[model samples]
Target chain A: MSPRLYVDFVRRLGNMTLQVRLAIDTEILVLFGPSGAGKTQTLQAIAGLATPDSGLISLDDTIFFQRVPGKPVINLPARRRRIGYVFQQYALFPHMNALENVAFPLAGRRDARERAMELLERMHLAYLAHRMPHELSGGQQQRVAIARALATEPRVLLFDESFSALDRPIRERLHEEIRALQAEHRLIVVYVTHNLDDAFAVGHRLAVIRDGRIEQIGRIDDVFIRPANQRVLDILGIPNAIRARVVEVGPSGALLDWDGVALEAPLLNAPPGAQVMAYIRPEDIRLIYPDRPLSRIVGTNHLDATVVERRMGRHVHRLRVALPDGRQIEAVYPASSYATMSLAPGERVRLALRKESIVVIAVHSDPPPIEEEPRLDRAKCADGCPKSDPAPVSPSPS
Target chain B: MNWPAFWLSLQVTAVASVIILVIGLACALLLVRVHFPLKILVETAIMLPLVLPPSVIGYYLLLAFGRGSPLFEWFNLRILFTWQAAVAASVVVGLPLMVQSSRAALANVDPVLENAARTLGASEVRIFWRITLPLARRGILAGMILGSARALGEFGATLMITGNIPGRTQTLPVAIYDAVQAQRYADAHLMVLVMTALAFAGLLLARQLEPPTPGRRADQSAKASV
Candidate 1:
């Protein structure tokens, strides 16, 4: 089936300060950005709540809005455009009960009561029909809003931070419900959100907007692994960045020289002897046994490193390791990895990195970190038992 | 001063208040919801009676309704120095109060709810009746109560426009004036007590219907309703 919505437009927000230029062809296009990036404005424009100065908005061959010079004719009113909008606050009528809110659109229409009941049933809110908006829980109110929006059987759906008010567990379930509904309906959803994690969770195609301009947009994996620029990298919270030089030009790919140690990096079209900042995800850097059979000195210098600081992350342990020049780099090891490794603070270990995962940001750089001594390493197991702490500087040569 | 004059005053006030509630509500809807040129001017013109002396309004009504008058010729009905003319005067005085308060309340309903309703395939008229009107109902009710109170207290314009023709045009206020002229203050006191009770009740009801917020109130109420 053809795409329901094809929006190729640039809209200037009120007073022409912020501009939103978007081009997308997805079942669900997630508009992700910080506040004032025009995310909600974009949703409003799509749902026909806000008018754009000039743009062609087409949904399945219907022209909703278009501004042509004197003969402008491509404008359709919001009611004529079959788009359902679920507001952030639910926007349910406080005076009406849950069923009435869901059935609000059906009023004066034939079989309105039956249709409203059916919609409530679909949203699993049939039993709470007579409950007012305040009486229902936050999650139930949201469902009523969803049902009301879908009651009209609109071709397009728009959301303005619909799950922002709910707690985590409820938010997760709502996301799942929305996902399930999208699967059933060939819906063109224009969703707005400020949370990157939420975007990553629900977004099949992610659009990162900064200061009203979409910095980058692509599939989730591509955007996460190969961000368009430094700003995109920062949005994903990947913090381990080091400035490097091309130490050696191998037949396979370019070797990134960090300080005096060479690291393998996936290169594309870059000539030998180039300077770049390498972005390494903490998860990919595997601390391994230096002499293990599976281990190879893939880079010029596989450095011996001592564990310094260890902190708890979401379901994992974050460890900071010290290199030779008093610089620390953070890496994550699962709780299972720490349990099996029997590693303690200040212990020496080898770090392994796959070539494909290391993203090279083509930019100017200072130098790779070189930590002389381990500073904040936790001298214990995952159980928090004390082990021998390492001295300031461990002079281990492989 | 007589029973018929007293009854005429009560009847005219009741009919005038009802007419004001309907027409004033329509005016309020136009002012608050629909956009047009001279909106502010029209709004000011409608609210002009609130500040104008009752005798001034009475003079205009007299010119409009008296025998061989242009307004009398246009309406083709007997109104001058009659109960209907008294009703016209009361409506003229009471209208501004109703329209002003109703407009304020309707302006406060949420535009989002009406838009949402429209998106659900409701016609413009349907949106007004179903979404906007119900949401702004409290405000409209308040305006009606206020109009009723104003109509009850209406005196100078009503007295001048519809002259004191006993049992025909003479209303409670006029009857009170005649009772005082005849030195029947005790009889006037009963009418005064009734009028006072009605005015107080209307004001109390208006206060009850007044919106919680100064400008905006409920969500659907802020939308267009005309």
Candidate 2:
């Protein structure tokens, strides 16, 4: 059986409380969340850098931390935990050369040089071994940090927004490198990032955190395609999350009244008259030319929409289209398609919301308004309609 | 010049700076790294010498190590009015500068870097020697310069505890006072020149011992990499 790390802890972080519970085996799990959402704190607790008020953290049989009320606390020091951590800034020893930094953990060994050289070579940093941290570029420094972290051959590795500092090209390359390293070492990796793209690119599983709580955790596809609640949908950065009401339910799926425009969704667990939220990926919503044949339509749910706005992106075109009820839905199409269609604002178009792709999330009673609603509305719509997505979104899944 | 006083002053300054460096570094590490109750009070006490009058420090030292004190009675240790007392006085007046400068240097070192070392399986002691010490070397050397200068010129405190005894307890500053009081103008002038020359040489030597600034090396490598 693969070794698993179990963490269940609560901590008070200066006017906020952090509570997290999760289990991770030998796989890459990305703690995805916004800034200050307690993702880093969770990693610190596991690494024994930050002690929790009460809880248990163990890897396989070795207990790293355990605090039961009215009982002895078993808290291990950070050095004894043997957990590798790659800090956000890399934090390479500025005084040491790349080789010395990688060899730090093996300080008293007879063959520390050879072992350090092997690790540096594995990171493709052998030629730059003598270079100091600030002398190297950001990407090089990050590689040295990783090599140093892995020098002890730790059971688990944690990265705290480690890749968020690199350029896209370098980041993508390192993502592939890290995945390869994980497979070779069979190390359980936990990466924290606020970027959806980085999370998807590097993670096998996704755990979305909000306000120090784990909002959702599952396989990447499971969590992204079938979020557990409306809160999960919001944290997932889905722009077209619409509050809808279930009008009918059947074995196939649920018929949802999305702002009076009826739409079909995959199998839902909610009953009729229950309020729910429908999330649709911009790429999943296809733009149908006005004169296209009826038999050529791809989805069951069709709605007439007027293009309210069109924004050009690098590889895709974002279009905000309005339904008959004045609610806006943002959709994206490949730039190649946009070159041919050249759809403009105020142009009437037909939109097909793929039933299989629409994630219907059950809404909690007295739900708080989404955080970006006010800013999103003030940016696009002047009438105070709650619309999401002022920030640039991920490119369409190609 | 009083050759005996010159030799005695050199010995005292050297001994005192060495002790100051060790104790000041320990105190600095405690202030920067460890957490305990009454930490602020401890820091304030360490810094007392920086603000207190030299005579006041001499009074406290007398109470602790003078005749009839516990140290003198129980251990039969007689430190008062000896060259060791001069060394002790120099250390007391020079320690605050060393601690203050070293604390600033150590505090400037990023805690994140130390945490990174801890995760890499390094003990606290190893992290200090390998990571913290090397990074803060320049600032610490600067502190040494300040401390040694203060020790070399220490007069008020040295006079209070170890009275001016030529060829025994009198340091160069006290030697100069003796020369001027006896109206030996030429002798005082020569000794003052020697004092100024020694201070300047010490400053130059510290600068020479320091490694090249990382900023310059980094800039060169950055260009090379580009």
Which numbered prediction scores highest in DockQ against the true structure? 2
Each model's DockQ score: 0.20, 0.29
Report fnat in order of the candidates.
Answer: 0.42, 0.65
lDDT of each: 0.70, 0.80
Q: Which sections of candidate 2 miss by over 4 Å?
A: A69-72, A241-303, A306-398, B201-226
Q: What is residue A170's positional error in candidate 1, in angstroms?
A: 2.1
- State the TM-score of candidate 2 restricted to chain B: 0.86
In model 1, how large is the Cα lDDT of residue B64? 75
- Model 1 residue A281 CA deviation (Å) reads 12
Off by over 4 Å in 1: A10-12, A17-26, A69-72, A107-110, A210-212, A230-398, B36-38, B66-70, B73-78, B212-226
lDDT (Cα, tens digit) per residue for candidate 1, span A1-398: 54557555566655444455555543567787766776766766776777777767777677888775675657677777878988776777766787877777776778888899988898898999888887889899999999999988877888778887788668767876776787678676777787654564466567777666778887654575568998887665665666677766566766887777777765433445656645666665666654455444333335577888778767567888887777777776565564556456788766766564465543222232244210111111111111112211211111
Estimate, for each residue in B1-226, the C-alpha lDDT of model 1 and write its tens digit: 2678667767877898789988998898888768998788888889899898877888787777776886667778777777787788889888988888888778777776666776666678877887677777888888878887778677898778677877777888888888999999898988888888878888888897784632243333212110
**Tens-digit per-residue lDDT, A1-398, candidate 2:** 88899999999988679999999988889999887788888998999888999999999999999998886899999999999999887788888899999999988899999999999999999999999887899999999999999999998999888877799779878887888898899889999888876775678778999889999998764576578998887888787766778788899987988766888887666667766655676777776655656443355788888989999988678899988778888887777673556578888888877775476543322333453211111111112112232433333322
In candidate 1, how many Å is residue B71 off? 2.3
